[model samples]
Target chain A: MSDALPGSLVGPVEIVGAGLIGTSIALACRRAGLEVLLTDSSDDHLRTASGLGAGRATTPDDRPQLVVVAVPPDHLGAQIARALAGGAVVTDVGSVKVGPLAAVAGVPGVERYVGGHPMAGSERSGPLAASSALFDGRPWAVTPHPGSTPEAVALVEALALLCGAVPVRLTPDEHDLAVARTSHLPHLLAALAAGALADAPADHLALSGQGVRDVTRVAAGDPALYGQIVAANAHAVGALLTGVRERLDAVIEALAGGDRAGVEAVLSEGVSGTRAIPGKHGGPTRPTGTVFVAVPDHPGELARLFADAGASEVNIEDVRIDHDPGRPVGLVELTVDEDRAEHLLTSLESKGWVTHR
Target chain B: MSDALPGSLVGPVEIVGAGLIGTSIALACRRAGLEVLLTDSSDDHLRTASGLGAGRATTPDDRPQLVVVAVPPDHLGAQIARALAGGAVVTDVGSVKVGPLAAVAGVPGVERYVGGHPMAGSERSGPLAASSALFDGRPWAVTPHPGSTPEAVALVEALALLCGAVPVRLTPDEHDLAVARTSHLPHLLAALAAGALADAPADHLALSGQGVRDVTRVAAGDPALYGQIVAANAHAVGALLTGVRERLDAVIEALAGGDRAGVEAVLSEGVSGTRAIPGKHGGPTRPTGTVFVAVPDHPGELARLFADAGASEVNIEDVRIDHDPGRPVGLVELTVDEDRAEHLLTSLESKGWVTHR
Candidate 1:
């Protein structure tokens, strides 16, 4: 048997604090065939996570081979200290690292502690929102303080590896700045949009289209946790905000000058440059083919068409439909792969479905 | 023939102007089975757009039923006057309605002037980048001046409808203010991000992620055109900027107090609000789905795995590969519809792939 801290073997992992980060870690760990030891002060959280099979609740006596402390930033330092003091190879998944690092100062065997953050998430939080594949292909940052032993760092990196995450090495300071600009600042901008809209009449919001939605997608994150993220990384976020402010000022100056073409130019720039960012899975979203299908205006017709298309081995990557009750025409737009596009078209054609390029 | 304009059946719809808006509008119009008449003083622009099939060159003797002027805001009023001098229902797709309307001076047959904007686009300019589906499912604002004729307004509204856009009515003042907050201000903010990054070391840009990209998406727009837009809409855009600036000052002040928790609280609020914005196509982009596949450590193994997945009629929504060169095991994450998810899993399972919830 492998002589690890938690057991004679290390097939399972133990996690403390089953909140969003903790539960997600649990989920990712479980997917990797590791038994998980989950411990949360709140029985409710533990019960919920255990119910989802993230892991069974455990105590230190359970002899967890590996322990992860996924707690609030303020509690992170002490928790890591306690875990290390208990002789477990410990890692804390917290957005803020310095404060926690300082908190654990001079703890015996502190070299066993490693700092980590899986840079993937949604606005939602809690165990119920957990999915086993949360960290499948996201960037995970690992920061080893000057005092951390190479062994501890290796274990943290191994954990990241097991979860299928890319381990990006960074100093604590660098990590904070990077997140402020990339994650926290974007959140603040999104907040501005939503807060502005909160005052709008409901009908206006109901009529809002995809642009508004895209601009405010991150606004729905858990309030307190995001607050922590921002406060911890304010300097980096502030720099980004300052840049944004300058641009705003330039735009305002242009508008004041009655330069109609100027404003159009500014908006068009946003359209092009923003598209460069990668979408899901780090792949830039570029449309390969657009196929328009005419379907009958009948209940269950969409399901039937989809089923028929599936039978013909046509995989629809994305689907959007335009319905006008006042007219006999309905346009269904499908985005698909270049290779399979012709096949999808031919399959639909064979099924007598009216379509166009 | 439908001779609504006697001796005026132009080669197609007469589209004056060949900038981004002009080219995009032409693309949509031509795609919808409409013959197009295109004229731009710049032979280069006309050639580029025509080469890309934005429209066909046409003669004035072929009188067209509709003539669209998609020019700079300052030039809109005069262009509308000239287009209407021919007695065809004419319209201008400009952002600011009041300025252009005032410029028109309520000429004879003033009712023929309907000002419209298909509330969609990008920062990229030029006809070469035009797409027929740019305006699909977007909100198109059709603003009618007091002098606009019912038929003229109706014709423009019909055009917007034909292009598969939702028609929303907004007066000139309301349109200006609403856009200042939504479009104009966001442009400025994105520009600021770009400007700041411009000052950042070039290597830092390599570290850029989606957060920076999303927040600064509009900054890369054609600086010249944007200048025109901002200048024309200054009053509204300026006022919105003032509001944003004031809020930002408050945030800075909070942080200065070292009220870390408080600062974090406010910032998190911003993040929560931003997440509420929908993703592409007005849907939540919170990712779902995961795929587990063991990859060998050999070179090109991971690439081959992805290629195989791509070949199996699956669009890999997102990817995460844990890095461990020695025993490189990759857990690939993919997003798929809930229905086809099982089918995909089974197929992978049949091929001896390992998957877990």
Candidate 2:
């Protein structure tokens, strides 16, 4: 097809599951002008994914140079073993790397397999929701054990590159533990915080605003799907969650005892922790100032604001919409480089935009 | 001065503490064509507020019909008492209601006081950060005790209306508990979650995405100010955090013991809880669908997208920008009414947008 994307990939790439990750990988491969073949346990999934031009359905005679097993955690081991037996370099896109790698350990062709997880997804799942660009600009964790060959790891890394993802190297255990802290822990905590609102009074919830919305946004994810994810990485996630629980308990105890220093310690730790998160482009966090402009909830209003910002030549770092409940007005907070924020604010005000400094 | 803003006020309004809230209230009152006077413990603050044309410096001869004590919680009671003794209808814009109201409960002119907390603010605080339009279309909770007269309650409600805020009525205790859930709990949990990132490896933290960012966004708030806010609402906030801790402990226990059902129960509860939060405009949550578009990091890309959507006549409910680490492109997720999502996707595609549906 398209001269097999600039790496170790020499022939068609076979994907053995046509779910969201699998179909997405297929689409990305196809977009790269590489031949792709897809298979799935469900006939409907295969038909749906192929119908969407993800790839043609796989045939028994198809001899792929590389295979991606994009199946659920419980089936990843068997699928990897099967792909390796078929004489293909293999990788799996399961969320948890350690367990899947562990299951495939000591298999006859173990050296041919590397573990990969594209760190991107929406709450929605299935091939219908898949996109070729899903992994673009995302971190695709490439986990290689001692048994994996250099060529095998390179193939997975090549796949990441072709998919427009940056390859992040980590050992299986390290990857799992890192995700436990950054992803799994936050999801569980979000769920915990959101669960507290399940029984709150109707009027009480009417008071909810952007803060609660942001904190609990991920809690709307499918519990069944998340339950499976958490179960696979339970040991690591459990440890992290336990750590958070202890911190939370200390905070409660401090507040209960009116221990101001203890309370301040925990809250200030949060400030420091959030400060550690990389800002735009994976750099260290830098302060940004906001210029809030009152925008009416109508078509072209946001467009006009951004156009005005464009005219001012001040690059917007980020934007947040704080809609006034039951009102036509929203506050569009434009975050710009701290140095440029004042210029942007004054420019917008000069353009007759009512800006809140 | 223009006629009093459809209220009982017959004289100039006096504002104390000249902070962000106080100065903002003064500006709003002045915008409504009412004369105002300002006082603060710090001369710098008084000067800064007056210099912004918020109001004039208060003098002993000033006889104000209404006095707003927009001071810190610790000083709210005394300020309200002082204002009431000066024969002015009094209210305080302290975040917490019960503690301050209790402090001035038996003062001779307590009947003239009503309690208010405007549900709006920026992380920045001071007269420099104040805006006359700050409270426009926001909720301003009005808490009146039995000692409050009808006229006093009307005066405070009228202030809220003049400030362009919707007045929500609740008892002081009811207000405290409600905010403990909506505001206080989310802040604590955000801080705790962000705290987990403090010791993480830089590389590990680099793997974070929008989910972590949203959950911990407010964790960047000034710890000293938040500490004070938390301290004033300690009992209510502590009780709620304890409940969250218990729920989190249950999750940790389930994960540690490999109890799938227990973990599922907690996660499912989180889903239900988040579902309870009102959507935009304070209506019940509705089904929305998203269309993703790849936008390169460039000035006015967002404006272009919104322009296209506007042309398509699809009202966007919300928009989120997911900046890809180390890439020039970001993914823009446009959420819209479910039925309109397809129209938006097709419309963007027609306009040469590579949309991922």
Candidate 3:
């Protein structure tokens, strides 16, 4: 495992939590040839992480060069302060930044702390769910307060790099507000939208399609956890929700009055909004066209189709498979660069695949 | 070609509006051994449909046993009335039901008409986008007013079956309200959620992940067209939106006030709402466990993994591939029945696959 690690990662690092993020970070650090020490308030969590090859218990003689605090938001500030007391370059992996930074502002050795959050996770939690590859290619936010030393910030950025993540730097306030709009608010709205289905007749819900499923997927996450995340960033999330409410009210009123233009404006806004999300690797969102190929529901069929696309020199940007229940065929939609879509369709057709635009 | 079609379909089926749904229906009918007569206001569309082997142009002497009016919502009333005047068992594939039904209630021969909406579509439109397999195993709602004769309703049901779709019967009012909650409301909310991203800073959106993408996927649909669908069902949609707004306000206020319990309620509600959506084949949602297999970023690797899983006697319920940009590997998450997850993981691992929880 250490063979794959970067040479820049220093050993003897201390992780203050053994939860999902903490254990995953430890595993990444361990894979990066760093000596990790795992600790958590619960002995079960600590043992689980240690057994998973994340790290062993810290010894008194092991003076760490870096300390990572990965705890719940409510306890993050205190944990950061505790880690900073060890005189190591301290950082955190909390979801929200500004609140915790402010709470630790007056603590001793505050300059040794840099706030960080990796924008990568799954619905699962706990040490058992940890994986070394969790942070790979993900965006990790590093927010440093003015009182922090440049050395501390650099150390945190280096750690993120060692984990194969792209570190994005922003001020604490900016980071909180940005995440409020991009992450927290979206989660909340997903929950809100999904919550509406609770009382719907079962027969109606049986007709739900991919549209509703995709829209509400994140709402199925743990409620208490999401509540805490939103609560931690309440001010920013609340402000954004207010804006959404105002816009929604207008849409509702327009819809109630049957105003076509008014409804169009709102719907158009959605188009522009979705278009703003960057494509793969943070590139500008490309206009991609889809080629729908009907693939027989067999294991090797999808592989053959993709192989054929690859042979044609068409790069597939994204793929979605729509499997009709009880059917032996699936619609495999391949999203490719718009300019190459026609070529791909013709190529696939010539190869005996049924293609639909 | 006719061998692929069912024998129940009669000859000389008339289809109005050679657009996406209309053209697709024509292709399905032609595949079902029927003599299809295609018509459209736009000559270009008619030609395109004909070029695609949907059907030949209709002549005055070409009488129809069944008539399908797959036109825009606003024009559906007139189109359906005209089709009904031909003395055929007429049906429509409009998105909305009650409004069009009410509009054509006074038309002569209205008793021959039944309102229908096929729960199948794509973002693309026009005759070139038609597919004969578009409706396979999907639900097609058939709504009839009290005046609808049993024979007329049976013909519409037969049409749905011939297209390989399950026909679900509902009163016009019930169909309108059910679709308002299941289809129309979800579409509008997706648009509203996506619209929220329009003014966000570019850098903020650069970090967006699959969560945001899934939530806003439907928002990328044609705005003018969606506006019309929402407008036609404005009354029902407006009422649903109003409820959403009310719940949203409560959640926002709770977040602003740091009311953890209140926020939890909203989040938990989302969990329940999403759970109400039936899984594959309209079955209760199964609790699935995922095993993450790291596959190299190359064609045929996914096929190998699925083949491996199939060999293990595990049926994969769903799959999602998370590709790390510029990385040599992608993580393929396979969801299977909870009981079989551990066995699958071990089997894959023994087969030299890198498995994660």
Candidate 4:
């Protein structure tokens, strides 16, 4: 439990909507040795969640210390309001915070309500995809509205910690704006970039490489679900999109007029932006070097290469495999600390691997 | 050598630059048992290429049968013109073919000139990054103009084969347009998206996820170099950017008007675009499934995981690792043929490894 809370959570925790998030939370709470009551509009989902040992069915006799509402955006306000009517400290796991917070602002016992958004998810949905470890080491935004009580906010933060996530406190508006900049805007850009390829000729498509693939990877997500998410944060996303439009116009004019300096300025800003992202472990970014090695494509080849790489005792920060369509060999790029790159390269070369830094 | 050519290249290939591409071509030619003569304006680069055994220094007495111009875009025209003066079957490895082809159009013996662009590269430049396997199984676009002789085009195609690249024939203008749609446009979009993050608050950036990281990866490339590449194909790229801008405006308008259907239409188009990309082996895309496993953040953990995975005898298509910053565990996603996913999951679980499909 968070120290800011007056006391530890001893529950009967009620979780509404036994979907991916709800079931996962139920599993986590059960793992923490708390009693959990689960419910969902879908009987099949509720049955599956219970069968997976997430929790038992809720009853009118049960009095929960905490109520977690994890449902779709359209039903969130109603579900949260209904949960709060049970006179329990309540929180809802929704991507956007302000709308839901506004929905229940005038409800009775509004001070008991808080908003949270877990920074973890998958392309697949439903209770079948739920895991107790889903939120392990992820960021869970604890968004408190002006009407939220201090104890309610602390309890929400404690729930985040109980699920093995780090709780980041913010006002509801700030959380919405932050996710709008980081998540919604990037997704919109990916979709826009990928949409250009829809009508391209086959010859043009043949020229595709890793760059286009990376930029459009996330655009393969479900359209309706993403539409709901983006629409919910329209105010923040619209502002960012407008700013991007201005930059796009600038680039268009620059290219039209052969203004090389203008193009470079935009590219240079991108470089700085990449640098601004925090590195692994939520720390400052560190300089890294890449070593490329050719690996034969087979069942055990990657295992052998990884074993050999492991023998060198270098911590690989990241790995990328570039498969050659016309050959049996794939190029594997391993990223490591800059200072130790030379050592890893020499070690791999000594082991008869064809490596290049 | 391509059968389209009259005969195979015997010896005495002249390379007009000692940079990454030139030296790599030189090494590939040498590996094929041909004599390579290398030259560069910088004596240091020439000495280094020679010392690395990529090729020997060029001399006036060396009468080469082929000349490969691999200089920067600024010097490509002059060098290709100079190479043609030696009365050899001439080709230049540059990204944009139309510009260089136009530069040498008026030169005498223009029938001997062909344009080639191998779709393989690295961020690092210079002779030190040269490798014989750099072009292995990659596409090499052979752009022949109206005046190019059959023998000259065939010889250029043979050069592509010698470097282990698949030759795809197209007109010079078509090649430019292809790359403009596939490569240049995606790069510009990535830069535009990343540029928006340059002035963002640190708090906002802390909410970053893998989606943002993948989308912005290529935006970290050298600004000046990318500026030149994009500028060279500005006509095609500009047209694509205009299309993208219209779509962006539509999305903004859709959001402002609360039109969820409009937003979803754009996203649905992006989904279709991703589906249109050719799968591995340049074949039709096949259905694939991913199995997720928890891995400890240690040196040999990957080796052990891969070794275990190989025991199932299922071919892995791709791998992605999602590291949890606050924990020692990283989630590794292994993509494989869809039908094999269940077998792999069962096998991994039997081996006492926790896995999910």
Q: Given candidate 1, what's the lDDT at residue B351?
A: 65
TM-score, one value per model = 0.74, 0.97, 0.94, 0.96
**Looking at model 2 chain B, which ten-residue stretch has the lowest summed lDDT?**
B1-10
| Per-residue alpha-carbon lDDT of candidate 3 for residues A54-169, written as tens digits (9 for 90 to 100) | 99987666678788999998999888888877778789999999999989989999998999999888667899989887787778889999988877788899999988788888
TM-score of 4: 0.96
The model with the greater DockQ, 3 or 4, is 4
Sorted into a CAPRI-style docking class, model 3 comes out as medium
Per-residue lDDT, model 3, residue A49, is 96
| Model 3, C-alpha of B1: deviation from truth (Å) | 23
Name the regions of candidate 1 deviating beyond 4 angstroms.
A1-12, A27-35, A201-209, A238-357, B1-13, B18-36, B43-65, B106-109, B122-136, B194-213, B218-220, B258-357
> What tens digits encode model 2's per-residue C-alpha lDDT throughout A1-357?
224443466558999999888999999999888889998989999999989898898888888888999988889999999998988889999888889888878788999899998998865789998989888888899999988888789889999999889999888888888788788888887887798888888767767778888999988888877888889999888878877878888888888888878878888998998888887777767778888898888877877888888889887777778757757888877888888988998999999998886
User: How would you order the candidates by TM-score, starting with the best?
Assistant: 2, 4, 3, 1
- The regions of model 3 sitting more than 4 angstroms off are A1-8, A294-313, A323-329, A342-355, B1-8, B293-313, B323-329, B347-355
Candidate 1, residue A325: how far the Cα is off, in Å: 14
lDDT of 4 by residue, A1-357 (tens): 123336367777899999989999999999999999998999999999999999999998888888999999988999999999988899999999988988888999889999999998866699998888788778899988887888888788889999989888888888888888778887888888788888877766777777888888889999999899999989988998999899899999999999999999889988998888777777888899888888877788888888888888988777777756567777787888888888888898898888776
- Off by more than 4 A, model 4: A1-7, B1-7
DockQ of each: 0.19, 0.72, 0.55, 0.68
DockQ of 1: 0.19
Question: Considering only N, C-alpha and C atoms within 3 Å, which residue pairs clash in candidate 4?
Answer: none
